[model samples]
Target chain A: MVEFGGWDMPVQYPAGILAEVKAVRKATGVFDVSHMGRLYLSGPKATDFLDWVLTGSASTLRVGRARYCMICNEKGGVIDDTIFYRLSEDRYLLIPNAGNRSAVVAWFQRWIDEKFSPGCTMEDVTVTTGLIAFQGPGTLETIDQVADTPLSGMRPFSWTESAIQGATVFVGRTGYTGEDGFELLVQGNDVVKVWTALTDSGSVPCGLGARDVLRLEAGLPLHGHEIDEKTTPIEAGLDRFVRFDKDYVGAAVLKDQQENGVQRRLVGFTLPGRSAPRAGYNLLHQGETIGAVTSGSYSPTLDTSIGMGYVLERYVESDTVLDLDLRGRIVQVNVTALPFYTRPRRT
Target chain B: MSPDDRRYTKEHEWVMIEDAAAKSAVAGITDFAQDQLGDIVFFELPKVGDSLTHLGKMGEVESVKAVSDLFSPIDGVVTEINEKLLDHPELVNQDPFGEGWLIKATMTDISQLDGLMSASDYDAFTAGPQ
Candidate 1:
């Protein structure tokens, strides 16, 4: 176990990281992601407030729907990546990384106070909620055994609130892995019950170890690993998630950046050998430094080395020949596109 | 759990010598090593027919948490590599001493075994090296 964002979480179980990763990729693995923060926003202006604050089109969110969004500073720099859910006309749920929970709450509080919404009120309910992700191909069957509602009817990026183990909980058809899965949000006090039930019932208990490889395999950007305050949406290749058509805190600058085009952009690549190129490894093109790697690992699924990095816009094209400074040696690399692993079953 | 039939090293590698035609020694990492590694992801193996020095760095093993250098516990030439590990590295975690055994080398010098700590000695050394 290691200390992550004030939580002591296991990096892996006795099954080892690779086994847990393969289990999730080929079958199913359960994760205790209760460390993630969950918040509730209530008021007549809840939907309007989120639409104004987030990058995605939250205005389109109907009750019982959720969408991914990024909260940005006025400079268009990401403050925290979050998921927004519209539970009702007067209520919404915002989930953010545990490390940035305080910052996100403060941002919402300040923004709402400054804008002065007559009905909008934000409450940080992170401590009251427990999050779990059961990911992989077999997750549906595992969840079906316990969930009162049929999980087969739920679509990707959608969710349903149902009763489980006599407790009201919300289940979302979303996961970090690029597989069929569900993320359950239950009350904190009910965490042990749900966890025990799932484990005793045969779902694999995975830890942070496989959680990372699964996300990396899916090409999903991690907050501290791939995205941070130093990186902008344009440079992270996350501009698609940013809505320029709508007015938000960072819209003006992002619009200018969009028109001018960012000088550097993120790209994914595969190492030529079994050796992995790690973060901070300088990316070189034609013997000149272009950028540095953000995250790198030996992809168990691809059976090759893969990584994500930022490179000069001109050098971000597919098939670009690049070299990574792996320790004192220069390792050859090929610029592949994001999502090194894409299973047909993911759809 | 250390098996009495197998010999152990302070570095957490185990070896079992058989008086076969070539006096071969089979080696694998201990459960303690796998426990510390958290999860085994990739294995970099030495090529077949490559000569290795006892206690020398032979290859590397990578896990989600960190990477570790695999050292040869006995000097000899690698007769076979666990090619199956190239695809399923988790076998090292599942059965570190059985099918997960990493390499089989012909013993060049039996004297090399003198330097390795016994199972009890290895356990003591691992508890906190003196």
Candidate 2:
């Protein structure tokens, strides 16, 4: 276990990260994500406050659906990437990174006090609740064996409440694993029960180590690595999450960046070997440094070294050959598309 | 249990004399080292003919979670690195005591092994008493 965001969390189980990652990819895996922030927002003007505070259009988000977006400062730098679920016409539940939980709350509260106070209310439900991710291809079948409500009809990015082990469970059909999965939230006391039921049904209990490797292989963005308070989402190739039609905290700058290309573009690369590139490794092209790796690791499933980093727009094309300075040894790298691995789709 | 046929170091490495006349010795990380590193992914081993100082930084042991320095328990000139680790570093985790041997080197001074701990001493040292 390691100290993460003031929480002592497991980096990996005794089965190890490689086994855990393979299990999540081929079968089913569960992650205890209770350290993430779970904030409940409500009131008549909650949507308005959220729309102004978020880059996505809250007005268009239908009830029971969740939207992945980033909370950015006025300068277009991302404060935190988050997923918010609209539970009702005027209520929403937002999940933020654990390390940035307090910052997100303070930022949202600042906006509420300035514009929508008395009309908007935010409640931190993180401590009182537990969140775990049930992910992979076999998740649906595995969950059906234990969960009372079938998630077959639940659309991707939608949420529904179900009963499991005589406890109220909030299930969201959204995950960061680049695979079909659900995020299970329950009362703090019932977390162990719900987790046990899932694991008892063949779900592998995973830890943060596997989670990082899985996300990197999927080409997903991570806070402080791909996106940060100083790096705008535009530079990170996250334009799709930004609704240009709506105005928000960083609307002008993000829109301006959309029309005019940003300075850097984040891309994925792969080397065919066990020798992995690590964060802070220099990206070299023609003997000149152009960018630096943000996160990198050996993909156990893909049998290759994978990494993500930002480079000049000129080198962002797919299949563009580049050199990755692997600890002073310059090695060739093929600029692959984001997500070095994609799960096989099943009907 | 760590094999008592070899000498153990405080850095969690084991050295076994292979040829006394040739001054050849084989070294690898201990079971404790591999366990602490979790899953082995890549090993940056020194090439043949490279000199390794006693308890000095030799290369690196990259695991699934983090990168840690690989320390040499014996001072010597590298004779060979386990070629298998170049392709399958997991061998370190699978058989840390046998096929996972990292380096084969000609020892600078055989007396260096005397100051090192034995298998039982290492077990007790790692057990606590830090």
User: Among these predicted structures, which one has the highest DockQ?
Assistant: 2
TM-score for each of the candidates: 0.86, 0.97
TM-score winner among the candidates?
2
lDDT of 2 by residue, A20-73 (tens): 999899989999999999999999999999999998888999999999999999
Candidate topping lDDT: 2
- RMSD vs true structure, all candidates: 3.6, 1.4
- Model 1, B75-97: lDDT tens digits are 89998888888777778888887
Give each model's whole-structure lDDT: 0.82, 0.92
lDDT of candidate 1 at residue B48, scale 0 to 100: 88
lDDT of 1 by residue, A1-347 (tens): 89998889988886767788888888788899988888899998777788778888877878888888788888888888887788888898888897888888899998888774777998877777899888888777777888777786788888888767887778888877888888889888988888787777777889987888778877888887677766678778888888889888878878888889998888899986456777888999778999999888877788778899988999888998898988667888999888888866545
The deviation in Å at residue A235 for candidate 1 is 1.4
Q: What is the DockQ (computed on Cα atoms) for candidate 2?
A: 0.83
